[model samples]
Target: MKYLEGIAEFCAVADVGNFTGAANKLDTSVAQISRKVASLEKQLGVKLLQRTTRSVSLTEAGTQYFQQVLPALKVLEDAQLAVSALQASPQGLIKLTAPVAFGEAFIAPLLNTFMQKYSGISVQCTFSNEKLDIVEQGLDLAIRIGKLEDSTLVAKKLATRHLFVCGSRDYFKEQGQPRSIEELKEHSLLVGSQPYWRLFIDNKIQSIPVQGRVRYNSGNALCSAAVAGLGIAQLPGFYVRKALASGQLIELFPEYKDKQEAIWAVFPSNRNVAPKIRLLVDFLAQHLVSDS
Candidate 1:
């Protein structure tokens, strides 16, 4: 273990076939590498290299030593590289994709914090409600909510996006709060484009089909319309927590509220994922979880 550095230098010089080339590749002086290899031979109590004034070749012992230790040395080197890469603050451009509203409202601010901590990192964020093929699009990471359909990507659950069946206080008082799922059909339902809301009931997932006078794809639109006394809409807690707390919107069905679900950071599998993606995923997960 103590002579690992020496072994590494010896391997490098042997592999490159010249001390100058090895020194250049290792970013060190040839003299230092030569000394380390000499030290390694002394420590091993055997001559491992046969060096000429102009060129160097492995001796029979050196050849045997190089063949055995070379691969293990490379493995040690790769391990060191991985550790060093992890220790350094992640750098490079990280392209991220997310839902339009969630990215702007939640993820963007957290990304600002991430950028401040990792000044070397640059980010390009695209906000679209549409589901994207992250690998084909060459995205570094993506934020997805609800149930994931793509099994190819690795999904790290960031936080629970607690949803609410909500209405304005005025509308709830006038229409009367629905005490059960069966009564929800009687009320004026405001539809998101998805047209269905999933809830957990009796240890099972229940999908409720709904209709409304007004329909919109955007969560913000649904939230804003509901605030303006449109009707009941199922929306995420982040979209309406402040409103509910401020009495702008009233959360309905406290007894039956089981609509909390997860947000995930998804990325494609790679042989060796760059530090940039790792940092972002970790930072996002930490920030989102802490905030929640």
Candidate 2:
């Protein structure tokens, strides 16, 4: 219990690598933060932080202690949030990120409606494929698709999506349908930013290389070209559903579509999930369709 005195300051310094940053985070003077941390080390009889002139880092024991305390702190925060959920007003600026194409097509519209519903809240959105550091970048939330990488961030599945290899009926008739993965090379396979396509074959996932007359980084453009009978292109269900339904595009290898991918809303695990943040996530989860 004695070591718990500076737990918040210690964690903040670990996160930002400086006492000045930790003081700024907790709204205290650097001297007070430093004194508290020194007293904590004395009580625990361990050097938790390895301090340098320019930066601070956690010792091995400090790392272990931090991991244990962080979750306990989060649980305490959750209890507080649950009690205040109804009392708090949703009034704040939320900064978030999402995939470029999906954000433009789906998330942007929902955000517009959310802002209208909560007149006091505003939004700042960044659309990019690069995995930006949410904690370092100070982002409140991030919307990610497909397989998520291993990280310390907390994620909530918002929806599901599917991928398919598709082409126009005219192109299929002229080039012939590909019966197997190897047969893909014999036809015009429109390439995307990735030179290879992932397909489910024989109950296993396989990355098969594909080549074609057209290459586009944008899924919308690929879908349009496939609809215009240019060549075959693999795209997500949301992009080709209308085309497939209208008979403009035919789904090739119907049985081999990749397993349903999850769309996620992620945020830094260390921060408390504020009322406004939770509200936006709940809104998105309620609105985003889970259908493939």
Candidate 3:
């Protein structure tokens, strides 16, 4: 336990790149932090840091040591927090980000209920279509839609989203329904974000170039245009489910629908995830369902 004291302090110093910053973060005196690190280096029989007045850097050995030990320290810290959480109620400000339409439609309501249930917690949410780096932005969590790229962050599956090729009933009556993917070239198309429509073809993913008289960045706007009999639009299930049910729009090809994508709650990978983040991820997993 005595040896462990400086391990966290050393990591803090490595993270902030300075003793004063680490000391401030740990709420300890610079002298105490310095002593702890010095003691640790003596015990290890190696110099861990090269310190200067302006900044500090790890030695090559120190870098290797930090890489090896950081994960273990994180595990220990998480264990300690897990024990504490069992005795304490969840309480903290959770900062999260999500896409605009989905956030407004679903996440915001879910958070409202979550806050109501956990009176000690508060939430800060950012709604944007643009993807932002959660770690650099200082966000606790983020809701990601569609395919997730290979990343270091942890992702918890929340729901599934299906893409639908649809057109208004009136448009289909006049322009004729496309019986196959090839026929789409003859009809007026409505597109958003991407220039090509993605669909499952021959048991594989296929991208077909799409051109349209109208284009929109917002899914809602694209759905609205399709509903107004402008053209066929490929949109997410959430954006067009109601219209499909109401007879305002008709699903194009059931057999050639795009592959379903997952909605995920993503956060920085850590051994001891905060209770606020854990609870929220669990809550969404339990409640949120696929729109399709």
Candidate 4:
């Protein structure tokens, strides 16, 4: 049992080919995953991975070890799932928070289904854009987007969100389409809390400082402004998807969309995660549409 400690971590890195992906899959921190895998290599006295800034590759010995262990791990995982499926019905009070728009558009509908499935389970939610300390608030979960402030939190990735730059056809016609990033200076930009917009231009990520006519903390409000032909806005796909599809808004510089951000369900690692909470996260991950 002592020697078996890092096998799962090593296996995860091998399958995902990156520590961050393994961390997401295992619902742990990347540092923890890296430590475990490094410990495993030290124990075996073999260099199993060739790690680079951008990629991870297997050594010849690692390939052989992986080929042998992957099937065994699969069997172990299958057995665990088979056993867990027969456990008691998960029921408890679950408290959580998410971005208002996302919670309203996606999480709320799934929650009704979750409550129906677990008759004894009760739910409470707080929808806000401001970040809250879940552990300090004595909350069970926090559904978050983009960078996580606390690196130690245990997080399971739920979905990917795309930020789209768009404006109404009338707005484009009046202002004239921006042929380049520099041309954006010629028109008004609608923005949120940040004055800088994160975008991919010329195949490189850039954070360009912007001066906008209107600034709102709400993505929904910014999206509406874009639809009203007030200005060009950068909004998440969930906020602008329908508008783009309906031709109410046209995607600007489609080839230069902002990088996708992962939507995560995060919890305090110090607390013992109850079955009810685990099941809820699993349900969300399974039901939420995945990009890959």
Candidate 5:
């Protein structure tokens, strides 16, 4: 017996509540539908339907199996649709939203390359610090940084944005480097949205709270301040990689460094996910992972 055919029959009968009604819906004979259901039950070694002359109903076991199999069948159908969409030409506008800084630094460049490769696909990318509802705003994809709090969106890891605690050479000379997380208190710190910064020390992760003379919402601004010898700032790797390499800013407390902060591509869970969105997500993962 064909597994999918059996599943189709089982679902049909479960939905229409009788072999005759199911047959009508499936555009097949009642005898054919009944045979399919019988074959399915034989294959699974489980009684899936209880029938009488006047009425048809599921057994206790059948009800429980139907509850599980129905959703599983739907997912299998969706997977088939997704594969079919992949074979079709990816011609669509992918509405995407991303963080203001990361979009500018990383995603924008990749989009340039991606667009060049897939000429048929066009992307309308928006950069904002404000989080928008992807479904509500009709967005196809979103690039998210850091650990996520919301479980509604399906997220795929793209890359890691490691945070670095650093200050310029001149500032480090004058104010001195932090020997430990505790020593950060002695210096003027440049901070961002969160009061606490993530750090890893000797195989342990810790969140250290630090006060700063100045705080900026923009990570770019905080990095600029640290470069100008304002104060030490805890910033992401992408923002400070060049400066750190140039010795404009020196990494502080090397003993307590997290490998890299996580970055993810998020999309709303729905039926018939667009090929354009799927293409972009997979492209991003490959592009970023290859570069890393």
Candidate 6:
């Protein structure tokens, strides 16, 4: 590290052509800069600078060495400056993952606004329902909905995900509405990923087995099918909020509304969270917690 430290001083003296000039540029004493250059030359077993009372110039070997090492030193300095800039302000690409439906409906738009606010920052999002390893996948953060499993990752709750049983007005008009959990079997069902509907009944959690004509792996797709009057579907509020508001879908068993799980911004359990990731999480929490 000592030898490495002198490289910068040598480069500075070579560039400025004098120890005093290099010292002023680096905010150090001329004697310190001179000693650093001398140490660097002694370590290299070759004189790197020719010094006089009036001026300083590089030896032939110094010129060749400077040409070779200056570019690499410049690269290192640039990297340090980039990191310092990030510490001062949020910037860089945030590699993120989220559930497809939520990502498209909410996170994508939220991130769009965040990027507009901080032009130095950009985001790459992977929308999938699959649970990915945040560390192994090298993702900066993940937006997760539903009960989080026990893990080593750090999670910040953004909001509560409320599950709703919903069906199109047309579907209910044709098949009639379910008055209770037991009556769900009598109606056509649209199931996503899970084959059973989980609900809170009689002050206890119940999982009712449901068979549907259309089964999908995506909540968005199931919500679409339900809106088309295919069947009743269990979906998160974010998926059906607009449909319910537009009178295209009706919420079923409103008294049975269950807090299914929570939405979370999850990241690796690192000692220090990156500023970009922390700021993004806070931004999301600010917008989503109220709506949830």
lDDT to native, each model: 0.80, 0.84, 0.85, 0.83, 0.80, 0.82
lDDT of 6 by residue, 1-292 (tens): 7768689888877766777667754557888988888888889999988878888899999999999998888778667655855565667778889988788888889999999999989888899888976654557788997767858878998888778899998998888888878788888999889888878888877788899789998777898999999999988887888898999999998777777578898876642466677889999998884334
- Candidate 5 per-residue lDDT, tens place, 100-155, comes to 98788788999999999888888888999888766545576788887787797788
Stretches of candidate 6 off by over 4 Å are 2-88, 289-292
TM agreement with the true structure for every prediction: 0.69, 0.75, 0.78, 0.69, 0.69, 0.68
* Residue 134 Cα positional deviation in candidate 1, in Å, after optimal superposition: 0.8
Residue 112 displacement (Å), model 3:
0.6
**What C-alpha RMSD separates each model from the true structure?**
13.0, 4.9, 5.0, 11.1, 11.0, 14.7
Report the CA-based lDDT of candidate 4 relative to the real structure.
Answer: 0.83
**Residue-level lDDT tens digits of model 3 in 181-220:** 8899999999799998889888987889999889999999
Candidate 4's displacement at residue 4, Å, is 33
What is the C-alpha local distance difference test score of candidate 2?
0.84
The local lDDT score (0 to 100) that residue 188 gets in candidate 1 is: 91
Q: How many backbone clashes does candidate 2 have?
A: 0
Which predicted model would earn the best lDDT? 3
Residue-level lDDT tens digits of model 4 in 222-253: 98899899999888888888999999999887
Better of 2 and 4 by lDDT: 2
Comparing 3 with 5 on TM-score, the higher-scoring candidate is: 3
Clashing pairs in 6: none
Top candidate, metric TM-score: 3
Q: For candidate 4, what is the TM-score?
A: 0.69
Candidate 5's C-alpha runs over 4 A off are 1-88, 289-292
